[model samples]
Target: MLPRPPRTVQVLALWAACTATSLLILRLGAADTGATPWAGPAPSWGEHLRFWDAGWYERIARQGYPAVLPVDGAGVVQQNAWAFMPLLPLLTGLLTWSGAGFYPLAAVVCLAASAGAAVVLDRWLAPRAGGAASLWAVALVWSSPCAAVLQVPYGESLGLLLVCAGLWLAGRRRFLAALPLVALAALARPVGVPLTGALGLWWLMEEAQARGTVPRAALARLLPGHEVLEARQRRGLLVLVLGAATATAAWPVAAWLVTGRVDAYTATETAWRQGAAPDVLPWLARSATWVGPHLGWLLVLGVLAAGALVLSAPGVRSLGAVPWCWCVSYCLYLLVFFDPTSSVFRLLLPLAPAAWAVGRAGTRVRALLLVAGVVGQLFWVSWVWDRTVQMTWIP
Candidate 1:
């Protein structure tokens, strides 16, 4: 027998286990929402065969976009609602026309696509980090907030797949090929803008590291207690610019098409909800609020403390470039944009690269944090599903 687990075997094991666990959690939660007879009602599946977002998407899928619908006291068109991103409904339509009758079928397609994205992410990060760490990285992503979006007729799964593929390709020094995939991802979710920027940052770092400018002394100063590889950073400015250009190309008419003004999209979003600009104090307070509700306090504290420690740890400062950039970008998007429930962050699910790097200093701690995140997410999802069924609201 091999002395150690082959990376492939480990990855397959991780995938199988995560898939089974997610399904089981979802199945138990779906028991109350009424499942389709074909998918069985005992163990059950999915909360409400026709859920709120699922209904909106299904309507779009089956009948195409209905521009206007009468709201409580006014006629509101979906285009103004922002729930009408085209990609998910488009895919669901294709599947339905091909005889997949939605619900379990759509969920199945979403899970399969998400699994594929996770595997692709594993493949991309394994060489940089190691098999075990890479598996954990992908698992963390698969278990993030609103992950159930993947189990509905949502574009999150496909959008994530495209984003992961783009990140993987970008990592391999294939920026040109990454552009279109990134564009597709952008079309699926606006958060692709920041993720694309992160990928470009990684490419740039790779180029910088390749140039041999990293001083061994400076690296040692950073990671005082650890040994590290000496390297130069890569040239990533061109890649970053290219990715930005491509993303812009995809949303070119956001102004003229959506609101008829150059930046009506922004006004529309702000008019919908109040969001602060990315000022430091406000961001910190807002982040705390968001994290408090979305993440357990212990988990939040631990992640923050861990992040600080890692930045100070040996060989980790440079390692932080990716995640720091991601955190910054995510913050900007979250603050400057609308729809906290939007598909953008879902597309950037490949943050595993940076997550892995951050995990380097304390693997066990990071793993525990990931487990906590998954458990919290499972509970949150189940609770929300239950609440949705009980309440009269359609969100």
Candidate 2:
């Protein structure tokens, strides 16, 4: 059969190709690592699932506060400082209490929420772009690192769902409706700060456009309604800033309530495998370091996609001031206090939505960029999973 035209057959073809590629990557990652039921003992699936934040959260769920014990030769007791965000654990506890297993319940919740996120993305972008672009958007999200979120009992999926929902609402100018969801996103992850920042920038842009560059007296008379615009913009900014701040602060407050120290969450992070903060130049150099040895094409694709966003997309350029500001801020946060793998994925989540928006410019261009990203992401995941599975098996 003759190949169908791009416009006629692209969406389903793209979706199928992406899904198949994802499954293939997963399979390759699991080829030697056969199914080991019950997360086994050797640092593999046999042992308890990769404990990190999940373990800390589970412990908090089972034991609200640690028993009083002496600290630093003093009689003061140290409560578990990791009990910061109780929402995820509390939900887990409720599920376990109701006869559902924690891990399985968490997996189901993440999957459902992620699916909901894809639905929201489709609805938000469908009207602006053709169905082809919408399909690529949802497919790219599903194929991204966020999908791995479903397998782990982490808050990523829930956080992403709320963030996407909030953005979708904001696109429609429904500021009030987006608030609670954005708040939940903040509670789930700190990345909500950039999200709120994006909205604030939008408000500022609208205000600047309202205040024309004419003589103040003449302009004031010509535009008597400028005060109304300024007032509306101020209100929008306030709602976004306050809502995001409250949501992001929720976890720290919970930690303070449980443990006397207000900075307990930061302290707990340090207890993990914390790496040194990389300087900006060194970080870029390090990311560059991986380019030629194992995968040249992948690096090239990444650069091209990022360049395309900067050069081709009007929507991206429209938010040019805000996007770069948020991107740099996020990079600074990632450098200061997170490990390499954790920093890479967590920092990328919020930006992926922006990338998706930018990549929707043309059918062929979007398809090429989307495929490259999905393939490169899956390849990276495969290598990491292999090492992780091996460590589990050996341990």
Q: Whole-model Cα lDDT per candidate?
A: 0.55, 0.54
**How many clashes in each structure?**
16, 14
Locate the minimum summed-lDDT window of 10 residues in model 1: 225-234
Q: What is the TM-score (0 to 1) of candidate 1?
A: 0.68
Which stretches in model 2 have alpha-carbon errors above 4 Å? 1-31, 34-38, 41-53, 64-84, 210-230, 270-315, 318-343, 358-374, 388-395
Clashes of 2: 14
Q: Which stretches of candidate 1 lie over 4 Å from their true place?
A: 2-9, 32-52, 63-84, 143-147, 199-240, 252-255, 258-264, 271-324, 335-350, 358-367, 388-395
Scored by lDDT, the top model is 1
How big is the positional error of residue 378 in model 1, measured in Å on the Cα after superposition?
4.0
- Report the C-alpha lDDT of model 2 over 1-395, residue by residue, as the tens digit: 99766642454455445545654565555554443443332333312233344555556667764433223344332334353455566666666756765655665565556556666655655555446556777666656653454345667667767777887776555678888888877766666556656666556555555665344454334323222235664576568767876777776676666567765555544444332223333334445556654464566457547655553355543333334334444544555444444336544665545554554677777667666666665644444443443433111
lDDT of 2 at 160: 68
